[model samples]
Target: MRIYELGDGTPEVSVVGAIHGDEPCGERAIERFVDEEPTVERPVKLIVANEEALDAGRRFIDEDLNRAFPGDPDADTHEGRLAHALSREIRGTTVLSLHSTQSYAEPFALVDEVDAVTRSICPHLPIEYLVETGRFSEGRLIEHAHTVEVECGLQGSEEAAANAYWILRAFLSATGVLPAPVAGDTEPPLSLRRRDADEVVVFRLLDQIPKGPAEEYRVFVDNFQRVAPGDRVAAADGEAFSADTEFYPVLLSANGYDDVFGYAADRVGTLA
Candidate 1:
């Protein structure tokens, strides 16, 4: 784990790089932020956990880093051990983990209900979407750390990089690390919700694509889209079907590698 020093105040924010190897945009974005180091005085720590997995340029060598957070110290994998240590180190750390997705969703903050502090600080950035954990999924980094995960954009996509640039500056400014927002950036009033009933849904990556060729026409869709029953979503070999009922899904991902194991949801009406 590497810490980049820029600001001068007490450490309050610990922004994380890619916990997953395949989603290296956050790692790359952090590097860019370091190169043009902002003058933040606050104790803002930035780290890239699971270096080996990240180096592999794959999601993980054995286990997913995001799911490994707050793990047992005696865990078998390096990622697990790292998560255990990292969790302890950042126990009281105000954290933000940048992430990306396949859909062109706007940059959003997906955090747990416990992260009211992070929710309080949301307005410092220009993200329109603020997702809650149950609203997205379990076993995610933000859920594990009880921190905030900002969806910058599609993983490795240009949007992810571009958003990371300005969002980093906004983070520095909002955290009082930087005296002001970075150039060409104005902090948008963050849409902080304790939880959006309408935003409730679990997300997953579809992994088991059908085993035959020419049946690969279906692609991932954005979160919260309506799925009609029997609607052929995508097919690996068999005819993939959708729910017959009318329920809104918070579709966090539209597509990824052929990992057809995505999430299904049961939303509890959100609080206004």
Candidate 2:
């Protein structure tokens, strides 16, 4: 149970990092901010979720921490108990939950539909991949606090770290934690959805990945971009598989019982 809190004016914001221990890249990034001790006009709390797992250097010791939010106090697992405590900590605060994707894509922000909070939020996140995150399971911290989960992009890359850096800066400025806004509201050329529906489909659970290091075969050329049937989307066992001859197949995102990362198949021109 490690909690990092800085800034001492009024408690208006809280940022959560790494519900999944293996996804600790965000934890490292946020800790950098906390250690720097940025002066603030308000109070901000940085919570290191699943500290036990963090210490062990794993994603989660018991269960998927993200799914366990708004937890039951009587949870039997350590992760679930932490989720319960965290839910109580983040009530009514603007939250920036950090994440990393296996996708080679640079970085993106997953937000809900356009609305007051989202409008104010979009401008702050420099990464441009904004997609609807649905209402999501009730009582998750982000849902509880109008929070947006930021995907820092491919784990273990300097580029990904840089993405987190710039976005976090924009966030700090927008919240008036830092000096000023780096840029005014910039509407991304594409809407929250991908530019092409046939390009890619986003999914969780990676049962379809080839297996072992064979998982390396799965590659994404674009960030949830679309493709057509017979197009090379992602690789299974590092081998490109042609898309199925259906519109739905063009938007193929496959997950089975093997991987946590679901996939996309290249559907070439089917949507066209």
Q: Name the top TM-score candidate.
A: 1
TM-score of each: 0.74, 0.72
Candidate 1, superposed: residue stretches over 4 Å from native? 8-10, 135-138, 144-146, 180-221, 226-238, 251-261, 264-272
lDDT of 2: 0.58
Clash count, one per candidate: 33, 22
Using lDDT as the measure, which candidate wins? 1
| RMSD values, in order shown | 5.5, 6.9
lDDT of each: 0.61, 0.58
Positional deviation of residue 169's Cα in model 1 after best superposition, in angstroms: 2.2
Alpha carbon lDDT at 212, candidate 1? 36
lDDT of 1 by residue, 5-79 (tens): 455654667778777777776788788878875555666878877677778777887787777756778999877
Model 2: per-residue Cα lDDT over 134-250, one tens digit each = 544344555564777777766556555556655665666666666674357542333233445333223221123232335354544344455455776567666665546422221
